[model samples]
Structures are given as C-alpha cells and as structure tokens.
Target chain A: MTTIQNRQILLAKRPAGMPTEENFSFVETAVPKLQAGQLLVNTLYLSVDPYMRGRMNDRKTYVPPYALNEMITGGVVGQVEESLAEGFVPGDIVLGNFGWALYNVAAAASVKKVNPDLAPISTALGVLGMPGLTAYYGLLDIGQPKEGETVVVSGAAGAVGMLVGQIAKIKGARAVGIAGSDEKINYLVEELGFDAAVNYKKGDLRQQLKEACPSGVDIYFDNVGGTVSDAVLSLINKGTRIPLCGRISLYNLEQADIGPRIQTQLLINSALMQGFIVSNYAEQAEEGLNQMAQWLKEGKINYTETITEGFDNIPKAFLGLFCGENTGKQLIKIADPAR
Target chain B: MTTIQNRQILLAKRPAGMPTEENFSFVETAVPKLQAGQLLVNTLYLSVDPYMRGRMNDRKTYVPPYALNEMITGGVVGQVEESLAEGFVPGDIVLGNFGWALYNVAAAASVKKVNPDLAPISTALGVLGMPGLTAYYGLLDIGQPKEGETVVVSGAAGAVGMLVGQIAKIKGARAVGIAGSDEKINYLVEELGFDAAVNYKKGDLRQQLKEACPSGVDIYFDNVGGTVSDAVLSLINKGTRIPLCGRISLYNLEQADIGPRIQTQLLINSALMQGFIVSNYAEQAEEGLNQMAQWLKEGKINYTETITEGFDNIPKAFLGLFCGENTGKQLIKIADPAR
Candidate 1:
C-alpha cells in the first residue's frame, strides 16, 4: 500500500445566484494507505452535472446539500490502483459516487466494476451510467410514450434530454426537441434522428412548437423549465404527460421565478406531471442499464459528451450547464488508466 | 301528447372575468311530446358546481365550452313523468346530464336510474353523484392516501373537497382541510372528522399548515388553486401526491395568475401531481360508485348541502361557489319528486 497525493475541488460557499469561480476552491491532499475492504482508485473521468448545483446549495433536496469546504461528490469512472478486498485487480475500471479528486479511497463494494470491452470507460459516467438510467426510467416509466404520439423534450441536447428523445423514438413516438442553440437543434434532428427540433432561443416558441408538433405534444420530457416549459404546455394535447426531470432554467435564480399557475391548464387537459430523480429507480438500475446497453448495441440510440480536460476544470464545466454551454454530458478528464 | 310549459336557462354570453346575472337568460319554453326512447324528466334537483364556471368561458377545456344561446347542461336529479323507452316508467327517479330547466326531455338510455332508498334522492346530485364520484376517483385513484400519511385538502368546504378529507380519514390518513371561513373550518374538523382545519381567510396559511401538518403533507387534493396551492406545496413531504381536481380561484380570472413555479419543488420531492376529471374513469364508474355507496351506508362518510330553493336561484347557487358562500355541495332545489 502507498500514499498518493490527490488534487480535489471543494464547495467554497453556497452560491447566491449563478455561481462564479469564487464559489469553488482547489486543494491538494494525500490519500492514506487503503484500509481493509477498501480499494484505491485513481480518478479518470468526473461528471459535472446540473444537479450538482442543487447539492451546492445548503438546502435539502432529493439529496443532502454538499457541506462547505468538503470535497464535492459525484459520478466518477476510474481505474483501481490498489485493492485489499474481494475480486482483486490492479487495472480494473469501476464506477462510483466518489469525490471530485484525482484519486478516491472507497469500500470495494461501494463501486461497481465496468467492462472495458463494452464501450468507452468514460460512458460509465455518461450515456451508459446515471444519465442513461435517468433517461430510461423517466421517459419509459413515467412518460410512457405510445406509438404515433409526439414527445417534446426541453434541453434536448443535454445529457438526459437527448437520451429521452431517442428513447421516445424507440417507442415509435415522434420526437420533437426544444433546445437553446441552432447547433443543438441540428444535432438533435440530424444526428439523433429527432423528428423535429425547435430553437427556443428564437422568439415565438409557441408558434414554432405548434409548427413542429401539428398534432400537439402528447408527452413533454422537461429538463429545462420556466418560459420554455410554459410555451410547450400551451400546445399540450389532452391527456398530456410531463416527466419533470430537472429545472435547470430556474435552478440558479436568487428569487423564485413566477409563471402561470399550471393547475388549471393541467386540470382542463386532464394531464399528468410528475417530478423524479434517478435514484428513485435504484432498485431497477440493472434493468435500465441492460436495456439502454441493448439499445446502444442495436444502433437505436446515440450519445455525446463535452469533456473538459484537467482536474481543476470541474467547476467551470458544471457552471457551463446553466448557461446552455455544453451539448451533452459535461465531464472532466482527470487521468487515464495505467493498463 | 300534452305540451307542458317549462322555464329554461341559456348562456346569454360568455363571461369576461366574473359572471353576472346578465350572462345567463331565462327563456320560457315547452316540453315537446316524448319521442321513442325518450323520457320526460321533471327537474327535482339541479347541481350547481364550480366546474360549471369553466363552461361559461369560450375556451375549450376537457369538455367543450358552453356555446352562447344554448341551454346550460349539467347533472340533474329528476322524476321521470313519462317514458317511451324500453324501461317504461310513469314515475321514477333518475339522473342525467340535463338542461337547467323545470323539465328535461332526453333519451332514456342516456340517463341512469338512481336508488332513492339507498340514501336521499338529492344525494344523486351531491354526495353520491358527480361530485361524489369526482372526489372518490380523484382522491383514491390519484392521491392514494396511504394510512398514517397526512392529506391536506384545499377548498375543504366544497362539494368534492369535504368528501376528499373524509375519504382520507376513512383510509386511516390524517386529514387537514383549508377553507375560507371559520364555520367551514369547524365543519371540516367537527362534522367530517378532519384531523385539523386551517382557515385560509384568516391568513398565515404557511404557519397554520405547518402546525396542522407537522408530519408534512403526503397528499394534496387541490380544489382551489393559486396561492392556497402554493402554500400547501411548501410543506409537501417526499413522494407527495397531488390530485388537481379543480382550480376555482383561476376559473374567473381575466389575466392568468402567475405564481412560483413548482417544478423544482416537485423534482426535489419526487412527487406526482395529476389533474383529473371524474369521467376519465368512465369504465370504472361502477366500481367507484359502489365503493362510495358502501361508505355512505356504513356512515363512514358524511355530507352536507347548501340548498338554494327555486329554479331562478340556480345561477346564484353556482355564483356562490366562487365567494365560498356555501358549505358541502352547493345545490339548487327546483321541485319535489312527483312520485
């Protein structure tokens, strides 16, 4: 066993609104020799998700808020540098909810081994990981997209939204995407095979959405809420289903943002709107991962990642999520496997 | 075939914000000779519900908006004077979606027979009628109040809401009601056996709700939307369920009421908020009706009616729902059963 120097990022303070660089701090620490039943894993890829912004705030959401000065914890794909328990391996790839550090020391059972032969190891933090399962359960279980129905996804180019649109297509539903940039809109329509993609940045989102979905939206997989959601709602058909995955648009606001009360619209339409987090389906993780992997194998689904290299870029990559900067899964490349 | 004089009400014009007497017009007409498969129903009790206010608007909802110059149609309990249908009857109590008139001529098959001995005949339009069924399916089917959970119901004094609170109690759940008046607060707690009652009209709804529901709200049966809903949402427990039955507060607003968006609140809680109308469970209507009837017979549920006497008072009864003037089901009594 050997002690290794680690570089980590910490939540310096709770953000007032849109977070700046000052909200995060960098530190150098030493990882002690692995204890019994623990594995020493060197970080390879660290996920910087929009949900992390929620954790930074000192408020209890689906998960506990991140502690001040503590290393931020998130999805990490890394190679085991040393092991002391169970299926012993020196160069095995694994995934776990670990720290935003160059290296992590965790219980051997706390992480799951990732097959290097399946796909890129980085996918364990992206399309094949938490985002994948989130898209699977949130869309299939809640959205329940039926054939010939139109499914509209906000944040269509983001990690979860893009997968939701593709899954909607796999269910034989018309996938229409609502995104902020023309680049993302094109990527959704041309690359991901979305039936149509609307650039919400252009004014008259209602008119654009109406044109894109002439039959009206049957399911709205919402990752970005606020005015974008309001416009999509205006065109929702009777019996519409809204899978409220995230509200990246309103996450950073210092004060609460107000919009039209949705109850009347929901009542008149006889619609269903449900909010969910990925861990809500923890018991069914294997089912979602297997199905998603099968879809990727059959060429029925695709994925993308905006990787920022270096250990210090995690906070910048995370803040980029709110500005609609990243196209798909935003990740940081910390190190490479020594295999 | 004797022609019988009748007093019918028509939608004179669509309401702008709040409906007034002028928006409705009384038209003297005659009951035509009964056609084959038709029954002559002498209106005994006409239901004036908050949902009727939606029909007064020109916009399309779950049901089409009532067209100007057309007779207002809703739930009516009446005595069948003559029938040319297969189920021939000279004097039989029945229920149908009929005109707001002294007598209604309708296809006999379109109406269902009401068992007067099961309870009171008027209950066919109150506790055991559309309002009853609305509360039944909306609460049980959507809210799914599990035992020991706390259910907070807004518009607790109204037709659907009072039953919702009682049904929550019947399920062994804690029922907390939000009503406008102290009188209704007393009725909810004392008469209906609610665990607690908050008078929203007295203000400090958040504090009252916190005190009333120390366990936090597991289910919310929303009949009145706007600020009342916003307050209830603030105290929702994880995995909370919201059954959006009606938004009486927003029904008459000329301008859309803006409030704090709820997507974040819902997402963090992994909650479900579904909007529903009674007819959505048309296939299961018998199941719901049978269950509700059983509860009523066992005295597990109690109901009250604020009766407005005379045919001309129908509009006043309907209008009173907005001002919280009535308790339980607001009803208009036009006549006694001819039988």
Candidate 2:
C-alpha cells in the first residue's frame, strides 16, 4: 500500500480578540488506513464561516469548543479516494465535517454522497448546504417575511445574508440589504435584485436605513449585530420578526459589547426575536434543500464563492471572514480529484 | 338635570424622567350631562401601573402618549350615577378607560359591566381586570411554562408579576420570584406559594438567583428590566422564553440604557423573546377571566391591592408605583357607591 501524507491546520491558541495568523498551526502526517465501514476522503473544498470563531473559544457554545492543538473541523466537500464502506464507492463525491485537512478517514455514516451532476460539487458546501439551509429556515420560519412587507438584512453581502435577502424577495417581500462596502451594496442591489442596499461604512446608518424602509421594517434578518442592528431595531414596525442568525460584528470583541437595551423597543411593537442555528431544523433540511435547489434551477436564486486556492491558505480564508473579505461563501480549494 | 361639580386630574406636563406631583394638575368643572346612550359614572377605583410611565412621556408606545394639559385615561372602576343606555342603569358597577377623575360621562359601548356578585368590585381593577389578563396571556401564551420548568418573574410582587408567578405554579412549573424587599420576597414565597424568591436589592443577586433556581430558568416574565433582568438572562437555558411585559427600570431613564447586547446569548441558547400588551389578547379575555375566577374560587390564585384613599391622593399613588411602594395592584379610591 502506498503511504499518503495529509496536511492539516490546528488551533494553536484561543484568541483573545480578533484572530491572527499566530492562532493557527500547520502539520503534516501520514493518512491513516480506512477500516471496515470507513471511507478515505480527499478534501476538495473547505468552508470558512463566522460561526467557526465561536468554536475556537474555550467557552461552551451550541457546538463544543475546539481543544488546543487539535485539528479544526467544519463543512467540507471531498471525493472518496478509497472505501471500505458498503454504500460508498471510490470516486464518489461526498460532504462531511472532515474539516481543515487534505485527507480524512471517516465512518460511512458520517458522510453523505453529493451528486456532482446536480449542480456543482462545491454547491454542496455552500448553497445546497449549511449556509443555504440557514437562510431558508431563519427567514421563512423565524423571520416569516409576509407579502408586501419590508425585510432588511444585515451583513447582506455575506453567504447567509445574500441568500436571506433573495429568499425574502421570492416570498414577495421587499428586500433591503445592508453591507459594509459600496461595491457589495451595488452587487446586492444591481446583480441580486435587492430592492435597496445601504453601505453601513458610509453616511448615517439610521438615516440610510430609514430612507430604504419607507413602510418601516417588518422583518429583520440579522447576521451582523452591533450598531447596525440597533439602527434596524429602532425602525421595526408592529409585529416585526427578527431572526438573529449571527453577530459577526461583535464576535471579535474582548469585552462585552454594550448598546441600548432592546426590550422596550420589542415591547412597544409587540415584536418577536428568535435566535437559531441551522442544525435546529435538521429534521426539515431535506425539504429546505429541495426548495432551494428548485429556486436555483429556475433562476430565482444564485450564489457566488470567494475561493482561496491551496491547502495552506485555509486559515487565511477563515480570518478573512472577520474582515468581510468574501462576497458570498468563503472556501479554500485543496486538490482536484484523480480522474 | 341638576349640574354637578366634577374634579379632574389633567396631565400638567410630560415628565422629564420620573413623574412628580407637579406633572398632574387638578381642575374643577361641571359634570357633563348624560345624553342618549351615555352613562354618567362616578369613579370608584383608579388604577396606577408601570405602563402609565411610558404614556407620561411625549413618546409613542403600544398606547399613545398622553397629551399635555389633557386628562390622563387608564383602567378605572366606576358606578353608573345615571344612565340613558339600554344595558346599563343607575347603581351598575363598570370598568372603562375613563381615568384620573372623580366622574365621567362615557358612551355605553366604552364601559363593560362588572359583576360585583362574582368577586369584589375592586377585583375589576386588579385580578379580574387588565393586570390579571396581562399576566395570563404573557405567561401562558408567550412564556409557555411547561410542567417542572423553572419560571422566574421579576418585580414578582407587583400587580402583573404576582399573578404571573401564581399562574406558573398552577401550571405545575417551579416559580422563582425576584422582588426589591424582604417583605415582598416573603409575600411571594409564604403567602403566594412561589417555590423560591430572591430579593434583588439584597447582596449578590446573581448568586441568590442561581441558588433559588437549581434548574436554569426556562421562562422569564420580565416586569423589571435592568440589572435584575441581566442576571436572569445570564442563567437562561436552551429554548428559554421571555415575555417582556414591562421595563419599569428603564421607563424613568432620561437617556438610553446601555447593557450587554443579548443577541449572542439568545443565539447560543436558541431562545425566543417576545413583547406583548394584554390588549393583543383581547379576544381571549373572557376565557382568561373565567379561568382566573375559577382559580380564585379554588384558592389557586390570590391578589393584594395597595389602596390609597381619596381623589386628592391620585398623584401620590401614581408616584408610588415608581418607588415600588405597592405589593400588588395600586389603586386610588375616589368614592364608595352611595347606598
């Protein structure tokens, strides 16, 4: 048997604030042989997301914190290089939480086969995957955007935010996007058909948001919580629904972020605010994926990926998420499958 | 018709922060004649609540702000002195939104008859009225306290809070009360049958609340929002429900109240928080009142009123609400019905 070397990235230390390159360590090790009911996967695409930052801390979150020096795990699209499992065959494209590694020996039950012909193999890690499912349930179930209602999305150019705004529009609601840059704002409004887009980095956010939402905000899909959220919350109308999907803006703070208390605003409008993770709807993920895939096929939905080439650039891609360096999904390409 | 002298308390000026005696002005005028379909009612019990503080400001809320120099209106129990209406007659006791006055001539449609035979007439201003209904819908519909769940109520000795804690117990949930004083704490535990009670004004509130709730809080009925709520929020469990009924602490603040942003906490726990007024559940009020009356009959629910005697004392009574001088409902007694 030929020996294969695997390159992996590990969390060197828990971050005190914004993570730097020093927080990650790289290693090379021999890929382990797959036992019975196990499959060897060669990583193709690795997803980098904002929620991964929470897992780096020592504190408990929805997912357990990563131990120091351990390989970090996240959504990965790969090809089965070898299979000792009954259901999987070599050359099958698959997706699993095999993480920041070039190769992984995972149990068959942990990985699901992805059809490359369906859309694209990488879509399994972005739109047809966790980020798409996140936007689906959070917007339709929690935000409940009604027809003719105004729906405002923060971090509107990011993976989940972009999909959320588009989904709101498909539901017959007016979609307003709030992005950090003018270019992202233009892309969201002009290319994605967002009803309006505001650059949070420019002008008065409150005034810009107010001008964007003439009927007052009925649904707020929040991915960036901070002053941006505070501004949107101030404009919420009666029965407003806020699906709190992420707080990327405050994720790097070393101390607690302070702002005006939102209880009074919520009470005055009889509003609803809920926080959720995509896994919360795991039971309904299939249905959500079907609808999302149909939307993609019909040209009602579209997605873009900011791909960083090479295995060693995974950490760089992950850190770039904090700086809003990605327009949609952020991924690192490891290697193409052997034909 | 003989002319009668009426004494009214008008909102002299909107309060800058906490209200004072000067914010109210007493005026004397002729009691308007009862026209067709109108009933001339003499005020019996005038309710004072934390929600009224919002109305005293020139800012909009779920209810409109009180206009300066206009008579302030709220829930009031009165006796019909004369009636030209079909359903109401002289000597009928009723409840209406005619407030801060010794007398009023209101349309028959505005006031509903209170059955003095079912409960004390004052209960129409407390247990069988708006406060009780507020606790019912906010706790049952929003809080959704299931059996064996831990339910925490801030301002647990106040009008709506007392009922909220009691309702949690009736549903077989553990009730934890947070009050400002030892007396109120004792009333919650010993008299009202709350499972555990903590005095927020005492040493180490977070530690005390942690001790009182062996299980993490699952439902929080928040009447007081400040440090007390911040402590409770820190201990909330997965799927926790918070019904934001009032924010008495922030109501008097002249500036924005700053606190740790709660979106991350809500996301980490996958929780839901909703704010509601009792009027949102108006259609279900009859079912709520009937159940409350049954509970009272079965000794499952009990209420107390901190009553102030005389029409001249209404301003003092309204001021006392901010100081937490009331145990349960606070009402000003204008006059007893003349036999």
Candidate 3:
C-alpha cells in the first residue's frame, strides 16, 4: 500500500503589485495514495505563463478564478510515480494540469503520458505544449498570413512570439518582431531568422516600424497590447488580421482607464482584430502539437525557457514575465534530485 | 429625343455641425442630347442615407469625399426618358449612382433597368437595394446569428436596421432593436417582428437591455455606434459576433472624445467586433438582391420611406438623420407629379 502525503505551495495572499517570496508558503507531508482510476505523479517541471495573472484576481472569467490560500495551478510535466489506473505504471512521464507541488494524485483522464523518445520531456511544457500550439494556430488560423505579406509580432522574444516569427518564414511571409531588449532582438533576428527585430524600449517606434516595413503590415500577432499595438495599427494594411493572444500591458491596471484608442482607425481600415485564449481551443491542440513536434524534431523550430530553481520561486518566475526578465518560456524546476 | 438637362445640387459650404440649407445649392441647366451608349434618366426618387454625411467631409474614405461645389452623388431610382444603349429602352425604370439631380445621362453599364412589373421601383432605392443587401450580408455572413439567440441592432427603425431586425427574426433568433423614439419602437415591434425594442431616449438603457435580453446578446449589428453600442456591448454573450456597419454618432465629431470603454469586457467575454462597409461585398449584391426580392414579394420584408418634397430639401433630410428626426428610410422625391 502506498503512503498518503500532502506537498504544496499555498498562496499567502493576493499579490499587491509584484509577488514576493513572502507570497508563497511551501509545505510537505505524507505522499498521498492513489484511488481507483487515479495516478500519483512526482513533479518534474511546472509551467508559468502570463495568463495566470487573470486567475489570481478572484473575478469572473472564462475559467474559475484561483481562491486565496489555495495552491496555484498550471500546466505541469511530471513522472508517474505510482498508478492505480489501467494503462499507466511507475516511470511513465506525463503532461497535465498538475500544480505547484511535489506530488499529485489526479484522475487518470486528467493526464497524458509523454513519449520521451520522440521529444524531450521539458518540451511538453514549451515547444510541444500550449505555448507552441498558441503560436501555430493563432498565426496560421487567425493571422492568416499570405506569402510576401509583412507580419509584426509583439513580445517577439517570448515563447509564443519566437515560434510565430519562425513559422512566418516557413509560410513565406516577412516576420518583424518587437521585443524589450537588445539580446532578445539579436536572438530573434540572427538566430530565429526574423527579417527584422525592433526593441520597443528605444525611442521612435513608429518611425522604426515604418523603416522596417515599407509596404505596411498585413498580419500582426499581438501578444503585448498597448502602445506597441497602437503603433502597429497605423501601419496595418486594409483587411489586416490581428490575432489578440494577450494584453500583458493592461493586466496590472485595475481602473476603467483609456490608454490608446484604436477603434476609429480600426473602422477606417476595415481590419479584423480577434482575441483568443489557448485553452478554449483545446480541440485543435492535438493537430497543432503534432505539427509543432515535427518541426521541433526536424530542428525547424526553437524554444528557450528561463528556469527558476525551486518550487518556492514560481511566483518570481511568473512576475518576471511582466518586467521583460524572461527570455522565452518560463518554467519552475520544483523537485530536488531525491526519492 | 429627350432633352439632356444638367440638373445638380452642389455642396455650398462645409457645415460646422448639422448641415443646413446654406450647405447646399440647386441649379438647373439647358438639356444636352444623350451620346451613344448613354441613357437619359429623369430622376424620380433620390436616396439620402446617413453615409452621405461621410462624403461631405474633406477626409479620404473608402470612397472619396464630396468636393465643394460638386454634385453630391448617391443611389437613385429614375425613369429612362431616352436611351442610346442596346439593353435600355425609353419608358423603362432604372437605378444607378445618379447624383442629386432632375435629369442625367448615365453610362449604359453603370445603370440597371428595374422591371416595375416585378417589384415597386421605390424598393430599388430601399429594401431591395444597397441597404437591404447591406443588412442581409452583414448580419447573416458576418454576424452569423443562430436559433433562439438574442440579436441587438442599433438605429432600429432606419433602412438597414429595419431589414436587419426582420432578417434576424427569419433566422429564428430574438431581435432586440434600439431606437430613439417610442414611435420607432412601436413600429419595430408591430411591423418588423422584433422580439423587443428599446427606446434609449426614454429609460435607463443598460437596465432595459438586461431586462429585454436576460440571456445576453449573441449578435450585434451596429449602425449607430455611440451610447447604444456601448450599452449593447455590456450584454453580449461569450463568442458574440459584432458586424460594425456604421458609427453615425461619431461621424461629425472631430476630436478624440470619451464614451464607454469596452475593451476589458471584450476580452472577458471572448467576443469579436469587426467593422465592414457594404461596397466591399458588392460582388454578392446580385445574390443578396435576388433573395431580398423574393422575400419582398412574399410580404416577409417591409420598409418605410420618409419622403421629402423636393431636391432642394436634401440637406434638411440628411441633417434630420443626425437629429433623430427622420422616421424611416429618408428619400427626396424630386419630380413634381402635378407638372
């Protein structure tokens, strides 16, 4: 018989501005025994995405908001430590929505075991996972990039943006990436084969973008919506498609305030701007992942992750995304090398 | 041979706010005989739509703005008094982009001869024409309303809104029309088969919309985009489709003004709001007109035209739309029957 245990990181309080070390309390207890049709998993890596910011608000959303004093939940890659399910056993690595904890006992249907021979296990949280699918579908399906068209992607050095720029190249569209730093810009253009990369922190973004895309923008994959999106809207051609993935700039602000007004321009140009959440498109995830995994295997796609060393550092890694501190996908390595 | 009369209305001045008699001037000239492949049409009914207000501005648009001291051009229904073209003959009713005038020579290709035996000639300027086709394609193709869902349409008793509400009903969806006057509301419900109609001038808008559409809005056909559209956005369901046909409320306002802020709610509900002009979909105009014609013959669709007495009153009718004075499709009857 397996012993029961509780290992978790509970939210100490709703973060006021930026989350600190005091916000997370990591605790350990007996390992929980699995029930019928359930499996016990030992956490390998936990994903940290910017969308998790909305969940902490305790407001109404497409999904339920995370409760105070509860464990923060997100996508996880873990090894099946024990199994009470029919098809799984010890040593099978699975990918699912396990949270910020050491061990998880979940219903069998909630997790999918990974094929490590096909791709690396960490890819289940990065290039072969939700972020990868988001880039693939949001660009191809919603952005609808045509050959020789100019594409502008905001958050160009992040997990989704890097892949989007590369995919635009594959589709014969010119990819222009917008990021926050010189290193990220160099990586996006020199390494990822982006046609151009603009550091938005620099002055005169509109002038820079005008110089980069003389023909004007056609497909814009908007990950960071604020002044960057506002500037890009002016450069967009008639019938341009803007796939709105995230609005990282507006996430922290709590009041009904206006920043950039785009509706007047949106109307004049007849551009199509659409907002999409990755999880809502789960039905197409398998198709997206299969294509992304193939690209990963063939060395056609690349990804980078800023790995935080402990379960206690999950909040730090998440908050780092807003400050432009993380280079690509951000993940937390929760487990120490031990049984 | 019919006399070629050069009759036109010129833009006298750019208006500061609402256009007045001082903004327009009428002139009549000696008739010049028609050239080969040209048809001379005696203008019967002249269309004065809200979009004509857009053409008055010096700014560039999908179509160029009306130049000062030039004839203001729009859709018209006329009787062909003379024809040098093979297809068009004398005594035939025709429709074309005939300017605000009494008699004009039109190119054979640009004018379509209307068969009065099939439908009323006035319909060629109203329900079976641009406004009908606009409402048909924008609602069904863009909005894509489903059965039992609530649809909210602004400018509820006007040409496009009247047709959109009827089209919504035909699709098995509940149509909630928003207009300014109680008379328009009564007409919308009693004549057009709207499920509900809201008089924005009378009561609390948001509360009334909530009461009318307790289930939340599914499709929003926005012809007037100021306060009414802002109110509708608050009551939209997740995945709601908005076909933004016009923003008549903001047409005259020059400055960046404040109204309702809706972007956060737009992200929260995962709704889509897209702007469109009818001329972009002109390729399908024949198909839309054919379907609309059949519906018109079956008594399934109805429209009203507020007929002004003369061509000189065109500015008054156009300005009345902004003041919420016109009851239905505003038309200027230029020809005197008694003469």
Best TM-score goes to which candidate? 2
Interface DockQ of each model: 0.88, 0.89, 0.46
**CAPRI docking class of candidate 1:** high
Better of 2 and 3 by lDDT: 2
DockQ: the better of candidates 2 and 3: 2
For candidate 3, list the clashing residue pairs, or say none: A4-A30, A4-A31, A5-A30, A5-A31, A5-A32, B4-B31, B4-B32
Model 1 lDDT per residue over A3-111, tens place: 5788888889899999999999999999987889999899998998888888889888888999999999999999888899789588999999999888899999899
lDDT of 2 by residue, B1-339 (tens): 689999999999888888889999999999976789999999998998888888988778999998889898988999999999998879999999995888898999999999889998999988999999999999999999899999999989999999999999999999999998999999999999999999988899999999999899999999989889999999999999999999988888988789988888999999999999999999999999999999998999999999999988988998888888999999888888775
- Most lDDT-accurate candidate: 2
Instruction: Report the Cα lDDT for residue A121, model 3.
Output: 80
Error of 2 at A76 (Å): 0.5
Q: Kindly state the number of residue pairs that clash in model 1.
A: 0
**TM-score for chain A as predicted in candidate 1:** 0.98
lDDT of 3 by residue, A208-241 (tens): 9999999999988988876787788878887888
Model 3: per-residue Cα lDDT over B69-144, one tens digit each: 9888999888888789998877888899977888878898998878788876787888988889889998998899
Expressed as tens digits, the lDDT of each residue in A1-339 for candidate 2 is: 899998899999999999999999999999987799999999999999999999999999888999899999999999998999998899999999985898998999999989888898889988899999999999999998889999999999999999999999999999999999999999999889999999999989999999999999999999999999999999999999999999999889988888988998999999999999999999999999999999999999988889999987888889999999999999888888676
- lDDT of every model, 2 decimals: 0.91, 0.92, 0.83
